[model samples]
Target: MSVAAADPDFATRLNAFDLAALVYEDGIAIDRLMVDFARGLAEAGRRVGGIAQLPPGPATEPGQVDLIDLMTGDIRPLKQRLGPGAASCTLDGSALAAASTGIRRAVAAQVDLVVISKFSKQEIAGGGFRAEFAAAVEAGLPVLTSVKRSQIGGWLAFTGGLGTLLDGRMDILVDWWAETERRRAKTRHRHVS
Candidate 1:
C-alpha cells in the first residue's frame, strides 16, 4: 500500500522531479524497499549507483550494519560499536566516505539513478551523505533516498521542497523510477544536442 495515496497531490508531485525521499516511520523496513528498488532498476539495465543499507548478516558483528554499493555490488560494514563509554552514534566515518566516492562516480558517469540509504540524524547535522546528495543534485542525477518520519523536516529543508516524497512501497518506487528515467533521458538528449 502506498502511504502517499492519502495525499491527493502526491501523483502531481511524482512527475517532473528527480530527487525523492522514501519516507517511513520507525521500525518500517525502508532499507529493504530501497534495495529492492535499486536492484530492480539495475536488473532492467539501468546504471544505478550509490549505496543501500542492509541489516547485519548472521556472521556480521552484533552492531554492524552493511551497505551494498549499487554500482559495484560491494557489501561494506556501515556501523561499528563505539564501546560502552562512547556516545550514541555508531556510524563508521571512513566507511561512509568510501560510499560517498561511489556516489561521486555515479554522478560523473551520469548514471540513470543514485540511491543513498537514508538521510537521518547524520545528514540532519550536515554530515553523512549530504555532500554527495548535493553533488548529485548539482549534476542533475535522479537521486532517491530513504528518510525516517522524524527527519522529514531536514529532508525537506535539504531538498528545498523540490523533492517528491514516496511511500514505503515497491509499486510507488517503480512508478517513480519510470517517470524520472523518462525525464532524465529527455534532459540528457537536450544537453547532447
Candidate 2:
C-alpha cells in the first residue's frame, strides 16, 4: 500500500475527504478508537453520519457483533449464527443492505462526515459496504474508515490513491474534520458571492 505522508492541510484542498485507512498494530483497539472518534466528532457538534461498529461480545462468541447507525443508535447484526464455530457464522447480507439504505439517506442528507466502520474482507472482495462507500465518495462526502493491515492492498486499489492513511490518532482525525468543514464553508461562501 502506498503510504501518504500525513498532510495536515490536505482536507482543506478537497471538496471530499476520503481518508486513508487508519493502520494500527496488532493488539491495538482500532475499532474502539474509531467508535470513540466518531462519538467525539458528533459530541463536538459536527453532523457525523455513517456507521461505527459496536464492540464484539465476549470471547465465547468471536466475530459476533452489530454495527451502529451513527445518526441513530440502531444496531445491525454483522453475522448470522449457523453453529458454534467461526466457520458456522455467515455474513448477514440483509443486515448490510438495511445499513446501506441508511447510508444512502445520510449521504442525501449531506452529513458533514461519514464513518464507515472498516474496509474488510467483504468490501475488498466487492461486497459488504463497498456500494455505500462508493456512494459516499461519489456524493463528495468526507469518509473515514479503518482498514486491516492485511487488507490495505485492496483498500489502496479501491481508493485509487485518493485516501490518506491515518495513524489512529483522535487529534489527527479531528484536524482533518476541521479542515474539511473549513473547505466546505469556503465553497459555500464562494457560491454565495
TM-score of each: 0.82, 0.82
Q: Clashes in model 2: which pairs?
A: 20-164, 20-165
Tens digits of per-residue lDDT, candidate 1, 1-193, equal 1213334564354442778889899788888888887888889898999989985456877667889888998887887777777877777788888899888988888888888889888787877788888777766677899888888987876665667889989988888877876776786699899
lDDT of 2 by residue, 115-148 (tens): 8888888887878788888777767778888887
Candidate 2, poorest ten consecutive residues by summed lDDT: 1-10
How good is model 1 by TM-score?
A: 0.82
**Cα lDDT for residue 7, model 2?**
38
